[model samples]
Target: MSGAGSVGNDVDIDIGALFASLRRNWRFILVGALALAALVLLFCLLSTPEYRAETRVLIETRESIFTRPNGETAADRPVLDQEGVKSQVEVLTSADLLKKVGAKLDLAATDEFGKPSLLSRGLIALGLKRDPSQIAGDENMLREMREHLQVYNVPDSRVIVVQFSSEDPALAAKASNAIADEYITLQRAAKLQSNDDATDWLEPEIADLSKRVKESEAKVANYRASSDLLVGQNDSTLATQQLSEISSELSRVRANRAASEAKAASIRRALETGAPLDTLPDVVSSGLMQRLRERQIQLNTDIADLSTSLLDGHPRIKALRSQLADLNQQVRGEGRKILKSFENEASVARLRETELTRELNGMKAQAARAGGKAVELRALEREAAAQRELLQTYLTRYREAASRTDHNYLPVDARVFSRADTPAEPYFPKTLPIVGATFVAGLLLLSIFVLLRELFSGRAMRPIDGVAQAPANEIQMPAADETAQPVPGRAIAEERAAAGTEYPARPPASAETIQQIYDSYTTIGDDVPENPHSVHAIASRLIETGISRGLVVSPEGDDGSAASVHLARELADRKLRSILIDMTGTGAISRTMLDGKTVAGITDLLASEKQFTDVIHSDHYSDAHVMPLGLADPERAMRAIDRLPIIFDALEAAYDFVIVECGPSNAESVKRLTSATTQIILSVVDPDDNAVALSALDLDENGFEDVIILTGAESSTPTPPSGDENPNPRPAL
Candidate 1:
């Protein structure tokens, strides 16, 4: 039994024995490597050396502020983007530009470009090949120049690199600098041609615009004369100004008429009511009334003096009383005349007011007519102004274009920033790298062969009897049927567990196995075991592609969401930095990852109610992070949905793999969260689910060609019950 056990253990490989055999064969590996290196060194020595020189051109518009056209700024200068720089590269390598450079360098007469092969010359002499005279000299030289020229654009910049190679170092430098100079000259010539074209185009346009402006101005003047709409001061019509003046005069006349009438009525009331006339302002202001009142007062005083000196029937007293009565009669007559004069003044004022009012009405009618004609006049003026503006713009452009063409102010869009210099060393046949690489490769190959031979010959085999004879650690597992075979990965995990060690993380499987997993997703029956369709397989593929972000979709509702939870956990188990974002509003991920706790999540972040640090929560059962859909209003959250890409970018930068669980989401709904490299994983519980097929087809049509379908046992994270124990419990009626 002991001999059989030792023989059984002989099949095991011993890493120590393999290394020992390799050490014994060190001389063979060294000899082989030295021979390979020697051959490479000889080849380098025999190869002809070619020298290369380069010139760099910066493609940009070099127009200065003073030289640029009016109303043009630096912002208006054309920017040379990547494609623009590439276009400049094509221009540099063009046959026309290269021919100019070749002619300048006299390349066609040089031996390198002008001379044909000896075999070709021999054949031509024998009439077996086409005669050399049949081919054009320029075409032959152009072909040779193109073969020697190398032009390319620098990545993410507006610089182009021009390189030339030749056996003569001085010729290489001269050719490269010549190419740059000729290309710049070509650009300047093209600009000059464009300016000439612009000047020719603008000349006719400017003339036409000037003619239109003159015609429009003449039409405006003729219309103004016919309609009698002459412009007055302050840009108003003459009729309007006259009407305004008449209206002002009419107002003054009516105000004076009213004042005169009021004064006449006041005097009349005083006469009727027996009030004092002297108290009246109009009566007191009159000189005639004042003199009359003084005379009457003197007569009264004389009568009083005579009554004291003479008898009651005296003739002097009677005469004085008669004089006083006459004085009162005269005062009454003067008061009547003053009242009549006031009436006359009121009458004249009223007549004048009526005449002015009629004149104002007539002027209003004339002004209305002028306003109607002024509309047409204004239309003509606007047309004239528009034409004048257009003429001025054309004249400005024509002058600028003509000035540029006349003064030869054309500037090329590119300049040589770095000119080529003669190189002292050859560019090809790097000696050290070639020899060292050959020696390392030869040694590594010989060592691998020796190690393989030792293992195949059983010299590297070691007996495992000692380990196999040791007591096996017991593993506790659920009881199953006897016919049930263990899964390969799970059995390995169980064996590791039994030996009191953690299950090791596995690297990505082969491409064939990954393709098989994808095929099994479409073809595997519902009765198939879940281990083959486990989320671990998807995790391995994710690791293999180095995908940092994934959009998880669940077509079969919460069941698929559970699978995404498992995927996140499986990725975390593999020691990858993974996070699960729960976009599903059903709180399925929250129940599993957060144990039914309501926390701030992506919706909260979008709503600006929480930040990234506040929303990302640690998974309760695993190392994976969880971002659950929070209590923020869904409508409000969707208002800021445009910010989802920024959130995804931040998460991708922070973690290795970000898995977003979108329950029952379509391509359009999740389009904002995906990128060109984002992996799409469809988590479905049933293999035969019709929703899975439909969703897959929809995703494929939407440009997601590599949709990964995760169909396996439901997530071990427990789903919430149907009753009211849910965190987001439904409200009762």
Candidate 2:
């Protein structure tokens, strides 16, 4: 967990760390800022300087003229008009005025470029290429010219200021004056043009309209004359009178004709009825056919009444019938007589018509006389039309002449009020402002770069800077077991006394059997120990570093393990001839550690198949030789430690140190081997416990001795200790 925590805390960079980084790399920041400042300064030096000149212009109102119509005084009018000021300001920047300025100043010639002057060539060589086309009359020059002349209204006043910036002060002033001059000239020209255009258009229009009026009048007169239209007031009354007279004559003729026919019918009826003509009523007054019808009705009534009471042969009935027949005959005769009377009446009507026709002819003659006057009037109308045409022509010409005369004295508004003056300066490259602005820009860029760099770097400092430290504790080693039975000597007795247990003369048959007897002790199991010694001599020296009581060794530790190999070499260099016993059934130790120098090892010695002297390699060092652990069967390796006293007695007489590398400490064979050794030396990495080295030192169980904590090497963090006031503090442990 400590190891995990250390890894988690590794990459954090706190404020202190950041400050340290800054302190260490301060040069980079200083260089960057200085370089920026230098660049800004250099740009300022290279940039062209510009100067400004300002002038004020007041918009002239009607009141400002100081003279007015009717001789009014200037004090009588308002001092300033805002609308007029705005209008005049707009005119100052108008395209028309600018174009006029362009023309009047011969700007076209100044805008073009010739072959490069020596100074221009030098400037070009310096990477400042000035194009001839850019200098030509275009938007750039116009813009530059405009920039030199700034026109603005003065606050709370009718007056406006015209400010300009240029390389030459006098030129700036002149350009400003020129803008005002050109604006006035443009105003005058525009007014004159407008007035002239109006006059020109009106001239031809007046002449043409006069001609059209004359032609219309002539057409009206000629129409009146040819149609003989009596346009007098009484003509309508006369026509009405003539119509009434003709109607009256026709009515009278019809009445007379009716009267005559009636008279003729009555006479004929009297004759047909056998009445005397003298006895007939005046049918002329009554209407001839009407009277006959009345008589017929009376006869018919008598016939009908008589037939109802009398037979056909009766005299009264016969008489009545005769009367009805006479009545019918009278009616027929009256009808024929009326028709004849109509013919005679028609002849009489023709005679009256002839007389009326004569009268009508006389009236027509009078009408013709009036119509002849109308014709004369038409001739007069034609003469009037010709005169109107002539009048219109003359009027049109007169109007044209009048308009031309008015144009000759064009309005005073067209008068030129001002003229342009020569400019004295060019306007561009404002020096102080450009340089100051560059400085500000450079500062901003530097700030942005710094901010971004700080944002992206993920760094934090350690959390335990002011925290208290924890105390260290000693590590313990595991106890011996059945496979690691004791050797016959005082060292074994000492191990037994230190552990407060009785010495077992013979090893247990199985690891479980030994575990049951020493239940209080957590013995090392059969696995390669983390930091095991290959030689007992090295183990004894490690024990001298502290104290180790009950020692456990494993057979697998003799070889194949880096720790075991290192221990064996260390022992040999310390002038000790160590015999490494491989009790694990594999001859890996002898092959790897000894480089296969001897074929016979512990297995051969234990089996008595080869003498111990023949298997052991003598004189590895001046004072010691080594008996390497060789290949063994599992059961045989387990039992190999039972003969440890014999091997040790042989080696003790010849050498001062006898180191044995045993199988894994947890194995039964290791217990047998450890019971023979002097003491145990437990090697542990400072920050590891899962490895076999720390497991063997079961500090919670069997305990340990001479535990040397070997920390994996690392560069120490630089931190000062508290108190003591020492400027140069000792390094942390």
Give the range where candidate 1 is weakest over 10 consecutive residues by summed lDDT.
Answer: 724-733
lDDT of 1 by residue, 1-733 (tens): 2223334344566777778887899999999999999999999998778899999999888888898878889898879777777778888889899888888999989888787656668998898987656789988889778888899988888888999998789999999999999998998889888888888888888888888899999999999988888889889999999998888888888888888888889888888777767777888788999998999889988887887889868988888888888987777677777778888998999889888888888999999999988888989999999999988888888888888888888878778999999999998788999999999999999999998899789887656653454345565545744763332224445756898997578876665665565566656544454454567667778889988888888887775677777778778867888899889867656555776678788888989998789999998777889899987898999999999888889888889999888888998887778886688888766668799889888888898887887874533322324342334432110
Per-candidate TM equals 0.52, 0.29
**Cα misplacement distance, residue 379 of candidate 1 (Å):** 2.9
User: Quick one: RMSD of model 2?
Assistant: 37.4
**Which residue segments of model 1 deviate by more than 4 Å?**
1-25, 115-140, 155-157, 247-357, 437-733
Give the TM-score (vs. native) of candidate 2: 0.29
- Local distance difference test values of all predictions, in order: 0.81, 0.52
lDDT of 1: 0.81
